[model samples]
Target: MSSIYLVLDMQNDLVHAGGPNGKSPLGEQVVARDVVNKTARAIAKARDAGVPVAFVRVGFSPDYRECPKGSAVFSGAPAAGIFKLGAWGTEIHPALGKREEDALITKHRVSPFYATDLEVLLRTLGVKRIYCSGVASQAVVQATVRDAHDRDFDVVVLEDCCAGPSAEEHRNSMQSIARFCRTESSEAMRFETLI
Candidate 1:
């Protein structure tokens, strides 16, 4: 397929009701935006359309060696005990229904393409376009769009499937991202047409 649907960081720690972020403000925004449900539906539609789906997560080792020490983004992960690999926190949210044949991408950083198998997987799949959806619109969503744009891939951000810390942040991030790639709501995305 020339187009692959990339679902970034819909992990338990980030989106599930009982995970670490579940009780925080991010969780409130997620619920308010209904991003988790929309993203799950989009994932199903993509698979039914015969489009490959890649689920991307950001996690680190038990000791947090892979986590950046100085960056404001991830430095607190160690202290907070979140985003650990191979744990319930890092697992794809159950409602999303991850299939065995689907690509499972574990990323140590925010950008899925940064030093990860995502690029190689995209190349192997002959993917020329990417459909993206995920949590924290200001982070993974924006990062993937910009990186994929520079790499010459036609990228589409499924806006309703992405949530940020606040409504304002999500709106601003989506506005900025619109400059580089396309943005569509999950309901408006027609994977069958892309495939």
Candidate 2:
């Protein structure tokens, strides 16, 4: 079976410097410099192994208000300011080394598969197993794992490649995801494991 690394929304809006979603102190606490470096290393290993890498980002159109203003998420981010397409805050985190050919699956909500073409892209690539890694483990990682499992794909989550609001949150999210998917650290889940 073919394997692909679905690098989740490690966007600047969530993990990079001066990002809108990154403005929170809690976000910073979880997304330390070491975590970012480790994630980059993992991605590099995947690239070297010829495993296809896809990027998922959460962003909206040029208009800052493309997202509905009445959802629960709106209560915390009512303005949807960071979702803008071309804004620096919405760009992928610099450490990921996004390439011109990398596929991007954009969603308006927390789930990368929600209203996105991610599933289709994976199917086209004949991907039977998906390895996920990204920020906000409690939200994005959890959602993606659940969705991937429900879709009948073999899911592997790189625990060290993900973070949450706090270290405890990260740990808890990994524990929860482990119930439905395989959990491994980036160090343990190198390209060799998948290839």
Candidate 3:
């Protein structure tokens, strides 16, 4: 199957220890998991196997015009000043080793496919399967896996490369995600076999 590695929401705000929201409870989980190193290994493996790499970052405009006002999940983003475009918090974590050739899809919401160029890019690359890894398993990872399944694309979640607000939350989300996609550790993912 033609495939792409989708690195979802590994932004500094969500993963970096020194980022704007770095000290938040949610961010601590990411740091503890060493998500950046794990995700970087996954990306390197994908590149070695010739699978395209796509990055999905969640960021709203500086004015927060795209942030939903009524949604509890996003209402505080504007005030907290996290995920604002052009800000360091919105940039991908440096340890992921992003290259210029990787495709970038920026979103203002939880799901990368929602109101984003993800689908178009996937279609353009003729991707039949998506190998996903990122921070916050209960949120972006869960959302993307479900959406990809509904969209008829094969989904694979790199369990070790994903994190959540807590270890329990990550485990629970992985269990739920297994119903929609294959879940495996980064070490077990053999991209050559996938192709």
Residues 45-66 of candidate 1: C-alpha lDDT, one tens digit per residue? 8888888898999999999999
Q: What is the lDDT of candidate 1?
A: 0.90
Q: Which of the numbered candidates is closest to the native, going by highest TM-score?
A: 1
lDDT: worst 10-residue window of model 2:
73-82
Using TM-score as the measure, name the better of candidate 2 and candidate 3: 3
What are the Cα lDDT values of the candidates?
0.90, 0.78, 0.88
Q: Candidate 2, overall lDDT?
A: 0.78
Question: Model 3 lDDT vs. the true structure?
Answer: 0.88
Of candidate 3, the 10-residue stretch with the lowest lDDT total is 186-195
- How do the candidates rank by TM-score, highest first? 1, 3, 2
Over all chains combined, what TM-score does candidate 3 have?
0.95
Instruction: List candidate 3 stretches off by more than 4 Å.
Output: 193-195
TM-scores, in order shown?
0.97, 0.90, 0.95
Best candidate, lDDT:
1
